[model samples]
Target: MNCYQKEDLIKMVEDAKQLTQKGKVADYIPALGEADPSTLAVAIYSGERECIYAGNIDEVFTLQSISKVLTLALALMDRGADYVFQRVGMEPTGDPFNSISKLESSVPSKPLNPMINAGALAVTDMLVGNTIEDKLERLLNFIRQLTGNDRITYNPVVAQSEFETADLNRSLCYFMRQHGIVESNVEQLINLYTKHCAIEMNCNDLAKLGFVIGNEGRDPNSDQNIIPLEIARIVKTFMVTCGMYNASGEFAIKVGIPAKSGVSGGILGSVPHGVGIGIYGPALDDKGNSIGGLRLLELIAKQSNLSIF
Candidate 1:
């Protein structure tokens, strides 16, 4: 079982919930903007049959950028490290997640990392499928197995909203295609990318997924290796260095755990060889992170000493 009590978790959520007033929901995607910014929740998964949560723990949100970590893992398993790294670099960039300046200047024009739009598109292109539908089904099935929730699926409304306003991502795709970093049709890739990003789940489900990664790819319930050990290490390492979208370094020093946050105000964190943390608070900071979620994580990590560093 987890170390913290239910009351302690609730208190931390209450403390962080106040920050919801100071931030805004992401309106760029209209569906995402509809979230109640005041919503806040936290869940901790500590091994088999043990989960604890506080606040609006049932609030479900889209995965957004958090899906990048999963795709990177699947891509590594499908294509292997050498082939995948050859298409994307390992370094972290200080620019925004959607910024394209680095792609233009970098040698060979590959994205600096898979966490960014350019690189994620490249990784999606390598997803080993006959068509977009085939690729998306594979991704959804993988996610369902990871969470042990067969009902997990993408939010069509959010997917449609993101696809309509994804011109910036479209541009990123075209640029990569010119450099041979991606070979799929631009629209198809965007459709698949948006759909995967729109996969929705509550913090509880997310925390379980995090547990698999931190537990060396083993399923806490079934004791099956869900992800390869080397691949899990690579994913968590990327989460530490690039998962927070250029705010990673600051988050590393403050929270010191591998985490990936979404504009929907969901943060997936895993303390290597320890517990998995999932938090959701739709009120976002200027950098698109969940402001209240970040605060709660800081408190939990400090109180529980969950940092890997």
Candidate 2:
């Protein structure tokens, strides 16, 4: 099967919009709650010059959990896998992303994986910096390099909203502290996590980032290696197994590619040696995946035989 043509991809985008009603916008954060539920968009990149877009492709949204993938890669690069893995396990939790129960039940209390809230918080703590500002700048710069866009930035309003409503996350952080899993200042770590989650980008930016990962950590445009090949392989493995939160198993069985979803209704997908896909739809299913976005990916994967399985 061939890569999807621009016209056919646009049609797929249009057809997937009907699924918007099947999910609801993520409103618990208040900032994410403001997204227009009817909006849907997609962008695909195979090379620097080969790009396809459809729907509200220009609309900017927060990275949310999708940022975790980048942070995990950075942590792996900054600190080797052994050090990072010591604080966080590699297995999926089979629980909700924000579940506190898993933290309580685990014997040693290490976060199950870097994709969950607990694990991401611990990974965020590993980002070497003297202050939260320094750490955030490092993260944003890394993302800018990945997408080849220097203009990427954080959404302060969204960050503030999450901070104000972060009682549960605070609890998780303190729980980690209690168990010796995280030793950083709780407020500072939460602030950094929330701020990174608030980083804003459009489908095109995400597709470009995915493009680099799809090609095994090399920038397709500059032909430069961004992330080490080994690190990229580890990150992609985690994305395939744990990226979609508790719904990861179902998504793997259906989509059969490495992908990550955010509550902001964005999904980042990479088809090894094939293409990178970015999708945005603010309506979230019960499992916190973008309803329309997942539908679009299923259609594309099925039609193009994009599934790795």
Candidate 3:
């Protein structure tokens, strides 16, 4: 396969940004709800090169559900996959991310997988640091290492807004607590989990962050292991199987790349040995994926022949 020229890729992003005009901006988190639905941006990066950003490229957005990937990988590294799996399954649930039917079923299972809310809470509980502050600090440090952006930090407004509006997630925690899947104090665990979701980032930062997975857990730019290779594979598999909420299957059939999306309107896509893409379009489809972001990825993968399949 041939590499894409940076300028060509940039034009593609510019072309794709037009998709934003057709989407509706996110409006649930209150803070996120206010994002201009028409806002769109894209960032692409590889081990040694970076290319084009259109529209709000520098605008900071919360990681939202995308934080699940980072915390799950770190939890796996800290506590091993076996222990983590015991609290969260590795299957896709073709249901809304916040579905309670599976949780209420007879098997009384762990969350269907780590990309969902229940699974992410379980993984957050597994982080090995001493205190909430310690755990968050470790997570932040880990994120900065992966993205090569040491100044990154959590956004308090987003955290507070999520905390205030997360009754469904709160209910999920309480349910897990009842089921013995989440051993941490329900309130504390949810707090830590939401704050991590509030970790702020932009398109460029997310693309660079995704490189850790695209390059098999190594920070290609720094030549260091941000995530162990084995852990990276597991995380990537989760991205393929459960990343786009209930749309994972469709995305696999269509775009065919490992990816994760956040309700805050960001998608992090992995194109191994080529590029990691970050797309932002606040509007969401019924499944909660970035409407424009999804279109942009499909177009790029088709044009650049980046599909893993």
lDDT scores of the candidates, listed in order: 0.92, 0.92, 0.84
Model 1 TM-score is 0.98
lDDT for each residue of candidate 1 in 47-106, tens digit (9 for 90 to 100): 868579998778889999999999999999999999999999999999999999999899
- Which regions of candidate 2 fall more than 4 Å away from where they truly are? 1-4
Error of 3 at 222 (Å): 2.5
Model 2, span 1-309: residue lDDT tens: 224477898888889999998889999999999899989999888875756888988899999999999999999999999999999999998899999898898888889999999999999999999999999999999999999889999999999999999999999999999998888999989999999999999999999899888789999878898999999999999999999999999999998999999999999998888788889999999999999999999998998888888
RMSD of 3: 1.8
lDDT for model 1 comes to 0.92
For candidate 2, report its TM-score. 0.98
Range of the 10 consecutive residues with the lowest summed lDDT in candidate 2: 1-10
The C-alpha RMSD of each candidate to the native structure, in angstroms, is 1.0, 1.2, 1.8
Q: By descending TM-score, how would the candidates be arranged?
A: 1, 2, 3
**Candidate 3, residue 133: how far the Cα is off, in Å:** 1.0
Candidate 3 lDDT over residue span 1-309, tens digit each: 124465665666667667666666567788888888877788878666564556678988889999999999999989997898888898898988878778878385678888888788888989988788899999999999888889899999888888888888888888888888888887788789889999988888998888778888888766887788888889889899899999999999899999999989999987766677888888888788988889888877888778888
Misplaced by over 4 Å in model 1 are 1-4
